[model samples]
Target: MNDNAATGEKINQQARAWYVRLGSEQAGADDWHDFTVWLEADPKHIDAYDRVELALLDISPQETKSGVLNNPVGKPEENPSDKIIVLQEKRRLLKPIPRSYLAGIAATFIAALALLFSANIFQSPANIQHYATNIGEYENIVLSDGTRINLNTNTKLSVQMGKKIRAVTLYSGEAYFDIAQDTKRGFIVNVKDTIITDIGTAFSVNFYESTLSVSVAHGIVDMQSPVQKVRLTKGQKAVRLSGAKTMTIASVEIDNISTWRDGVLVFENAPLSSIVPELNRYFKTSIVLMDEQTAALTFSGVLNISDQDKMINSIEALLPVRVMDDGRQILLSGKQ
Candidate 1:
């Protein structure tokens, strides 16, 4: 064979291998990512994969049902002549093919085409979608699988659904997920180094500067980091600081935890230091504590997030703090 023909044959073999591997149950996110990279590396890879799929379909049902396709390649008893006869009878082959090529074809034919079809690995752009919300804005999204997601201000996330799994990656901010239970395809959410796996659950995940918090309102979810793993159930919340080896799990009020979903911030004795950061996510004007004593003050109330001025006024009225707005930012100081 010429150099060009030899290279073509090598690519064809690789395409067949990828088809078999992807159809197996062991295929994962990394496998799919690698396959996509390979497919896009050269246009000929697409054509080669298509030929392998067509070749598999051309095989006779009687031969496939008889378990001839399941036999491993390079078996001494397996006859390449038998497959060539079937291909020739089906009018798919115009000339004689090599025995080694026939062996590769037989091995690839063992995988069901249905799995490949469901995967839709080639149309990656369509399979993966991104959603985001601007500051002071909230958006609701319902996925095809009936999963509902409520995105808080300045939040960004991506959803990628595969044949065996539904994955969401939260880039920043907060989101509440009402997952649709699928026993065969598990739901997972990824935030930085943390992984949250849903088990028929409704939960909220918040990813701020140096903290990651997961609060479960219903059902259960498993949260895992590099060094720790914990299962959270209804009314439970897990908080982990950046680079921490362990997470702090505590019981919480689900209603109070999810009040942000209703366009309100509910705080029960939450410190001014923590409240300022939450408010900063919604408004363009940054909130700054003028002193440590001011930051230590606690407030307990529900404040409407829609109006920034009203929220600031409510905080000033409810707590012993003075708010000073210099047009660019708001400064909070303990009352004299």
Candidate 2:
């Protein structure tokens, strides 16, 4: 064999190894850093890795259906060690051919793809991942498929990525979802008894005090309950009250729904009663209305939640109200 052909073969092997290594659970930040260095060391490395990835994608369905790849929802393998032996046998069969031969080249490419599938690069749905944020805390998460999720204060959720679906179960609090469109796999969110399926959209789901609220910012979302199903488009919101079989759909101001993400709350002539509960979500200190009349007062403004004292001062200055802090809680009463 010529030295050029031998060098190309070696580069292909290195690319395959890097691809599998990165897809595995063990790959870390350092591994990724080194991979970048290697990829940039030679332009051929980029082409080689791309070829390996494309080949795997082409053969994945056949391998998955034939049981060569791990089924996302299947039961555990009785003999996990057997997978290594099978991979070794396949490698041995492909290793003896000359690369100059067309059949040999095809066999080698298929062997590389087989190695990836046999290694179980795609995570199974059974491997659910749980994420949470503490009171007054927020978090951002990006999934393997490029979907982005922003968890609001005091939130908990679990994510499962499968071959046909990308699912998230919101156990509590609120989350904004920016779904990456994939024609093959659908994205769905489970909030209480409601199932929200994205149709190439960006949306938010808030579950608080036995109530489920969904607001769509872009594209479309299909929400299904036990009794009914509804589709929401941009500027639309759905609210399902506790113990109700059906949800109410309404038009909403889209910008107001996501202002909390910027550490501020925007209220347009919103009453004190409705606003206080939202403020409580971000702070340990409770804000209580001293009288019914105080709760009835309306305020229209933006309050920065980062500073509790400043937020309270702004509320008092804007409305006909007096704020008293007893250390335990902040009490609001109509100014006499």
Candidate 3:
């Protein structure tokens, strides 16, 4: 083993010894002090000790009832023997029958540690590869599993593929996925607090504020959160508001929903407040609505996102509002 690996093994051995000694009635004051000093000396020592205690509980439940997990090193006794831990360990080996049985117990401890290490590895943001689009920029990505992802403007996502799992976490904006079938491995997408599991199908997810809207173009998906469970099929859409126990379901024209990926955004009765944000994503110049009344106004139409000035003028004609262009921005207010 290399230096780092060798050091890790040494810490595990020390932690195992300390755990057993503290559990018995023979641990002295010096044993407890040495443990505290070792624990304080390195941050990894504490983690190692925790794993040791957990492993003992899993392999030896009867010992757990003895209160080995009470404090810094379990409950301490005033009159304790330093040999108590050594004698207890000897009693365990007196009944062993074969080499394979000893190996099995060792494997169990290693497996428990492997699980902890895997969780730590995935918790780091760097584990997954990141893909993001700037304002007005769109992208098409083909994953290793033959999954096609089309990202809309200002969208960000992360993907991590393992041997038996494919996981993606959507950070902002929207995207469309065409997933390939893999019966042995499941595909999971995380949106806000909800999890979307694809059953060999394709879908789209839009995240805005605390709400997430999922539209399925083809196939089926199971959407779940803390308090709600919903299954959706092709040509169906669902919207979930933050803190709501249930989702609002509706049928949609799946063909026109994600048209923005092709340079066209079609909105059916979309609000002014919502429209302005979509417009801002495609233009460097910002659109500001002056009043709440104007923001609540809704309109329906197809917008060509390529031409910002024409789109702004088009909205001005559709709504009873005046649009003014200062030297820096466009301002809209109820005609007055």
What are the Cα lDDT values of the candidates?
A: 0.74, 0.75, 0.72
TM-score for all models, in order of appearance = 0.63, 0.63, 0.60
C-alpha lDDT (0 to 100) for residue 224 of candidate 1: 70
With a 3 Å backbone cut-off (N, CA, C), the pairs that clash in candidate 3 are 26-81
Model with the higher lDDT, candidate 2 or 3: 2
Please provide, for model 3 over 1-336, each residue's C-alpha lDDT reduced to its tens digit, 9 standing for 90 to 100. 899999999999998888878888888998899889989999999999989887754222111122221211212232222221211221222232356544654554465346334544545644567776555666778888899988776567778776566787787778999998988778878875577889988899987544689999999999876456799999899888654546889998988768876676788899887777667666656777878888889989877676677778788889999998895777889986
Q: How many steric clashes between backbone atoms does each model show?
A: 0, 0, 1
Task: State candidate 2's TM-score.
Answer: 0.63
Clash pairs, candidate 2, are none
Off by over 4 Å in 2: 1-126
lDDT measured at residue 90 in model 3 versus the true structure, 0 to 100: 17
- Per-residue lDDT of candidate 1, residues 56-140 (tens digit): 7522111011222122112122111121111122122124445655554444333323433344463475667776665676777
lDDT of 1 at 7: 96
All-Cα superposition RMSD per candidate = 30.3, 24.7, 29.3
C-alpha lDDT of candidate 2 relative to the true structure: 0.75
* Lowest lDDT 10-residue stretch of candidate 3: 60-69
lDDT score of model 1?
0.74
- For lDDT, the strongest prediction is 2
